[model samples]
Target: MNRRHFLKTGILGAGTILLGNTLSWAGEIKRDVPIFGPDTKTVGGKKHTPFIKAPKKVKAGEWFDVEVEVGHYHPHPNTKKHFIESISLWIDKLEVASAKFKPVQGAPKARFTIRINKPGKATLRAFGYCNIHGLWVSFPTEIEVV
Candidate 1:
């Protein structure tokens, strides 16, 4: 009837319902809130690691680039059945931005240019979801602003 109700029901069912062009529910089974895997996995001879590329140090008021890529070491399929759905960027526990992709027409990568005006230690993290493999998160990337 409602979205929450639908999601709740869908999560309990053995089928996945597409939530848009970007998200889906995989059966009625629930795992941890955010699912992540090891740094490297040998799937089909390719390494599927959620890699975050950013500067180790930055100026307080300067703009810098941050790139979030899935299967950086290995290549993930970009087909109708298996592909990355979305990639999100987070600073500490605060979500800063997100990007979504369409299967067969999109790659599992996103680039962000951001400016932080405070000098301190900042924890950067990334989250991505695959159509068939569910969710995956990156190991934290810590940056220093001076």
Candidate 2:
């Protein structure tokens, strides 16, 4: 084969390999975040789903504590092989706070102090990621800001 032809073929082959790997990785990462379904009392749901704790009402422009815990009914494992890796708090589709934990060293919980500038109803959601179980989301909690 000519040197130019060989070089072109090699470059195309490398590019194809890289593209294939990237696509596969993206596909793996696109798994839907799990949430409690019709059977909300399942053990998996209790172990993996995040639970949000906040007051029912708060004054506008005043900071309040929001706590997120990975498990409410049953505690999730925190071993070296499996654990909750991170937790994120979202308010009406906007991420407000996040926390990371090390296996066997940190618990899968976080407290975020935040305030809403305007008086209205605010929706809060929490997401927890586990190393073995992918991602889990909590039910939306609504708080009235006065």
**Which candidate ranks first by TM-score, i.e. highest?**
2
Writing each residue's lDDT as its tens digit, candidate 1 over 1-146 gives 98645643454232222212112322222444434343453462133447899999999989899999987878888998778889888777677889999998798899998877889999887777776565666778899999
lDDT for residue 12 in candidate 2, whole number 0-100 = 37
Scored by lDDT, the top model is 2
Q: Model 1 misses residue 143 by how many Å? A: 0.5
lDDT of 2 by residue, 1-146 (tens): 88545643554345334333232222323344323211136676678778899999999999999999986768889999889999988877678899999999899989999988889999887878777655566777999999
Number of residue pairs clashing in candidate 1, backbone atoms closer than 3 angstroms, sequence gap of 3 or more or interchain: 1
Q: How close is candidate 1 to the true structure, as a TM-score?
A: 0.71
Prediction 2 TM-score vs. true? 0.74
